[model samples]
Target: MPRASRLAVISAATLLVAGLTACSTPAPSAQAEADGDWTPITIEHALGTTTIETKPERVATVNWANHEVPLALGVVPVGMAAANFGDDDSDGLLPWVKEKLDELDAETPVLFDETDGIDFEAVADTQPDVILAAYSGLTQEDYDTLSEIAPVVAYKETAWGTPWREMIELNSEAIGLADEGDALIAELEDEIAATAAKYPSIAGKTAMFLTHVDTADLSEVSFYTTHDTRTMFFEDLGLEFPASIAEASDSTDKFSLTQSAEQADAFGDVDIIVTYGGDDLVAALTADPLLSQMPAVASGSIVNLPGTSPLGTAANPTPLSISWVLDDYASLISQAADKAE
Candidate 1:
């Protein structure tokens, strides 16, 4: 089934013309036919400003989940980063991605293996008109190199910190489908709200995401901060952030932080602990001299996601993966929250 990969490590628009009526709304599109020339789409991000001069017919996305935007927008990318985590059957395609491709009846595109890093060579081979990495962790050097191949759309603020809605908006705009992106975002927001409402027990409960726990060693605990999209998704699901985590995240821009397990009591405010692991990992956590004392652990309020399955990736929240695993994820969290009660 699922592969053994840690999730903590993983990392379009059309414009319609407005009618003459005052009540008519214009659909989002990057290039409104202006004087027989297309207007360039300019996006500023942490790396640099990316200006897409034309609608990209051959899209190439590097880094995690960037391709999903183009694919969800009905534009198949020429190439994209291969799935390095939660890839069941070792097919390089996550289940949702594969399902989307199958629904479109399109063949799989070239998958750039990002096991080491961005495969510049594989990306360049695609000869793409534009590159999308709106939710990526691309360094300045990586941005510069990728730009040489095509116009690169990168994360606007922090690396791997872009929310799913923004990721869709930026990536879709680069492809001249801004309006469509907005609609897609609305759809997902509604879906999330409806699904979360079904799990009332999780509402207002504080949660923390532990990143890739090492069962053999409980000396330290590493967790995602508010800056990471995974933590941000808690707000989307009606979950609150533990005040301790918020305070710890205040001084750094990093997506993750680690502290000695001896300080586990600091996280007593956390009502639920969500992390990638199995029963043994849970056993290990509960058995730990320090960690076992944390309220979540002592109360059995931890949600252990399987690291090897597509469902494990659901905590991070992606466009396609939401519908695929939202109910299960929410149910688990709600159950854990109930335990806290």
Candidate 2:
């Protein structure tokens, strides 16, 4: 989901936009790790073996993994970095995340302005014991820099290494909540099944997933046909993918990228449209003849995502926004799918 969007990247200028259904701390409490464990768990990062110092105190998280586990485990990190960047026009994880932290009366961590590049000096000053870099791209330079601050746990196989589930396990283990982490995953699985059961019609339905590119032709379009982050969200509601989308993905060696409206329209029957936005999209549709003609649009079934804000990420899969998001979007998803009729 962190794929580079060709659409002009949000400059270092903005604020944010923003989870998931299941919120849990994993197995293995930090107390367990602290007991008889001087275990040398090496995270193969660009900088090489990042050994954990059992029972991390001051922690810093950058990407999704950074945001999720830290919060779920009841650790108010000393420093934080958002999963992505956008303007305050859409709430980023900050507001929602802050709410949870506030509920616990935990001290809020310092958030990195990702647009301006990660601030190593600020992180170094925190003197963190363990660093959760799971959802981050540990560039050679960044890695070198972060290692100086603390032992960094980067992705194992790829940049944002490992599946989301694995990420939970590993990050949880790192924090010594392995048991809690496993249970959290279980609860999430059950919730997903129940969610899917609620929208029986969404199953087998086709959907077109895209984010606003620019003022022009809606910029970049990402069409998901199968296993991916957005898929879970749609599947939870029993939503289906259009035939055209299935075909485009069929031609891809990896994930397919949509470049134009023609490619976007490939899923002609894409009855539902879910994307990141504020009113730019709603306004755009009303202003743009082409977009206004989308079958989903003509049928009045489009759901313009709440743009970037502190809690907007709730529509996505993350630890913080999951609980509140469902309550927020339930009406929208049900109505959108119902309108496809």
Candidate 3:
């Protein structure tokens, strides 16, 4: 049986694209080699100082959230944890990332599947100089174990709960890619801006980052506030939030909004709602009593996300998915406008 989070509403084509992006080649860069100088560097982490040896060439990453950071900085991992959600054997590499790698002609690296659990022996077998566990639910036990094999970069804070920007910056510095990370983010922002501009209808509209909650309770809902699910992925588009949501958020999280039935409807007045959740959640919405009556759904102004299983935690937090959100959601919004045309 597929995991609850495995349910999705994206098209097959999108899934294929997302999968391809996950395994795509790394950008044009010279292969990293042992530079001899091992310096202790103190880098900011979700927890605290993640002191590790400098310029680790053969790195292994457990979590996929920071996968793009290294790629963005041209530091392809010698190995990455297996794709847990997206492509089973491939690890959670999204097709967008794969495509970008292909664009750069980067080689695909070996992947470690952490689904069963992290394989300490297997990871050590990769002979990785440094290990990155950024954006993961790694326990202290796991941290201790992995550190024995190589310096581990586990969550400094809650798994994906950390800021995407900070994740990018932190991972960049950790992998010696801070400058490139900034450049990648800048380019990504430019891409978001261009795409947001292309979709004139969504501009200045209040949009609620959505997730199809389990249809059990019509009132049971969740949303992406500021610090929620990288919903700020649209900030570059200059998208605005509705007064109701803005009031509710009051500067809470950046990624998601968990609200009641009344709170779900608060997004009713949102100009265009493009939710990011699984098919299970969508199923709940379609069958939901009160949810069906919400203004956005009733008016057909809601654009259900078009990404595959990748849109869940793993997909939303990565750099490539940030762009994928715009592509997937922007197209949906544009199509909505076209249908009216």
Candidate 4:
């Protein structure tokens, strides 16, 4: 079953040559031996602070893409949330993650696959020393429950609201690899800079990252806000969010804002309408009287994203997803910007 929160749209190819060139080798691990003594570290988060007495050898990750951080940092998690939305038939692991595991010659980590919510039993079965969920939407109850088994490191402020960079930093710190985390972030940033340079057309364009839902009468129309990772991904690419989206947004934590069809004209100023769906979604929106009026749509500046594509995986940027989608993402944005021009 597709998780509702797993909503996004985009595509990607294999890691770009530029990204590979920027990060020539895997980042070094920050285990207790490498970092000298494992000094106790205290981390403040939305739930409260969690203190780690020493470097954790058995790390377990919950929530979207949290496992990637430890994997990218050369640490294999003992357990992790299954890739509910994008996993192939191979035991709930994404291709990139599976590839990394193969390269490390590490045993396939235990996967927790509870669709309704967190699988506490499966997590506890791993007997992890620490549980990393710095980018998760786990509530206080969930945190308290997980804390019973191991120290739980949750998000900093809002649920599912930590930025990609912060997520990497927090996860790195949890595993006692703060310096390697910083280096990894710098490398990813360099890749983003190189991608921007390669596709000058995407810079400075105003974009709206939205999810279109066509109800019985074309009443449901909405877009994601700056709080959403998909929109943040556009900002990473140098695309500006239009003020119109802010005016329409009502809640900071809500992934998207659903508005009345009468207010569709509010989207008129956006240069690009980036959405997730099939090609027919474009046709559906273009046929709607209210939606067709938007400047981007009328001008053919709409970019339809496939739900399970690499670009979609990148809609919620992770340490690994960014590199996987950067080059193809740049090309998609450039194509839309050209139509807008």
Candidate 5:
């Protein structure tokens, strides 16, 4: 949930445009590829099922980080939602995404800005053959509207609930690259496992993911639950979520749980604390009378991640992002774990 609001806006705009463009364009071509006999494939999701009758040439992506899946599989989308964060001077693309596009010599695709809901005209102009939002929090209405323009593949169960591996596999299958998707998953898994092996100190440690709010009374403190991608990232590194956190969590589906300043003592048992904010966040937490009691903060075993930094992007844990931040992220966790030891 590190960048949830940004993601929410992007996804909401995608759904809005899909509705507006439904009646504006002619249906996509029905012709199966003439070069190869592309078999039809059906993908089931939370909203409904979408069957691709042929290999789609123009792919469009909506929602957070779903575009990376297609890019990682060597397919550049015809259009994609613009990233509002972590893009730093590269138009609407993250650095890694731009690098991949350069490697493929592919022109930068059309980027839909979601500052004021869906830009129906822009999305329609791209003329995408298929729209992928398999990691989004789209509603049933959103799916219905999008399906009118082109086949839409939505998240499998809960919106934004698909694991990173499933997101890649589903998107690849949507683009007729299921085998390539499996290979990509295996390769990334190997990379993650290899990175974890380098950080032997991370194993058997109890870690917590939290975010600091710049508030007058420190009222915005939040702790991530097992449902969050950041926690999953730690699990990949062989760290366990502290039992104290599980007992404190209130929502089953949400990624994080909020706590008042008085509850800071709840984090005392956590060996390592991963958080996002500015440099002063550690100081702020330690200054809080209640939070200072926590051992991790007392000993300064806290990792403060910048909101737009590469490690911050890894906190959201997409297929490409995990690779981008693995080495640095692992080293940071190892250093924090060492403090606990």
Candidate 6:
């Protein structure tokens, strides 16, 4: 079952070469390490500080799009978490990830199925030199278990709250490609800016992403709080968080929070709403007296993304998926923004 929090659903991919000029350059740190000289690098994170004593050759990534960091920097993981949501195909790989593998002319690596939980035995069998989960929600126990397998890079701050830039920076640096990671960040920033520029309507609009709304249960509302990467991506797309969301998020470290539907008026300031569902979900929202009274719902300023499609994963930007999904995602948001009252 798909977790209610977008943070729980993992996604990945690689960017097109034409759009990634930075990827063409050889990373200086990687080149130096290739010559048998590796400088020790220590990283501080919410879990604990991890030090990389030597260059890692067999990199493995657990949880979410951590694999995209290495794949974006021209390093394929020996193993990584299999796609659990928005896969589109039953191959356990998202489309962009599959495309990256094909572009690299390499076969699929060992995919650790994470439906139940972290498959420690499967991750151990990969024999990874390091495990990356800079954007994951790994618990202390998961971290300790994985640490026994290899050096682990967990989230820097709140779990699943690591922005795309930091995710790339931390993961790439771990693999001795810090410079390349910086380049990747610059390229993506430019990409986001350029795409956002095309949808001026979405610019400055206050937006909020609703989690999987139970159309059957209209008594409560669940949403991604500011700590979530999906909410963070709003800024990347030139969207502002409604003051209500910011205020609600200010008090909690949790990535998601629920409020009674009777209090749905709190989101009146939101100009556009994005959520994972279909037409029926939208109808349900508009039909509800409390929800329909909200400006966005009454004005039809909502983006109901199909949860099962590759496009459904667009809200949570990653190194690779941004280039692939930004245009369509922005267009949807822009259209919704135009309807804002």
lDDT tens digits by residue: candidate 3, 1-341: 24222222112333453456457525434222344444566766554456765477777777655677777666777777656566533534567667767767977777666767776656665666677766776877677666656677766566666556667776776776677888887887788778878888766666666665555655677776765544665555566767777777786644555677755555666666666654665566666777766666655565665444554433265776777666666777665444333
Q: Kindly give the stretch of ten consecutive residues in candidate 5 with the minimal lDDT sum.
A: 26-35
Q: Residue 223 in candidate 4 has what lDDT?
A: 80
In model 6, where do residues sit more than 4 Å from their true spots?
1-35
Question: What TM-score does structure 2 among the candidates reach?
Answer: 0.74
- Residue 312 of model 1 has an lDDT of 89
Task: Output the TM-score of candidate 4.
Answer: 0.87
TM-scores of the models, in the given order?
0.88, 0.74, 0.73, 0.87, 0.87, 0.89
RMSD of each: 9.3, 9.6, 10.4, 10.5, 5.9, 8.9
Candidate No. with top TM-score: 6
The regions of model 2 sitting more than 4 angstroms off are 1-38, 43-49, 82-93, 160-163, 213-215, 218-228, 250-256, 263-265, 278-294
The sequence of per-residue lDDT tens digits that candidate 6 reaches over residues 175-241 is 9999999999999999899999999998899999898699999899899998888899999999999
* Local accuracy of candidate 4 as per-residue lDDT tens digits, 1-341: 24222211100111232244347533455344544678999999999999987568789999889999999989999999988876646468877788889988998899888587887767776767799999998999889877867788999998888899999999999889999999999999999999988888889999998776663467768788888877888888999888898666544568788778798887777999888888778887888888888888888887777777656666678888788778887888889999999
Residue 109, candidate 1: Cα error in Å is 0.9
Identify the superior model by TM-score, candidate 1 or candidate 6: 6
* lDDT value for model 4: 0.81
Candidates' C-alpha lDDT = 0.86, 0.62, 0.63, 0.81, 0.79, 0.87
Candidate 6 or 4, higher TM-score: 6
Per-residue error (Å), model 1, residue 196: 0.6
Instruction: Assess candidate 6 and give its TM-score to the true structure.
Output: 0.89
Alpha carbon lDDT of residue 148, candidate 4? 69
lDDT at 280, model 3: 64
Per-residue accuracy of model 1 over 1-341 as CA lDDT, tens digit each: 12112211121000111112124423444225431355778898888888877657789999889899888989999999989998978999999999999999999999999998887767766767799999898999788877767789999888888899999999999999898999999999999999999999999999999986899888999999999888898899999999999999999989899999989999999999999988998899999999999999999999999977999876788888888888999999999999999
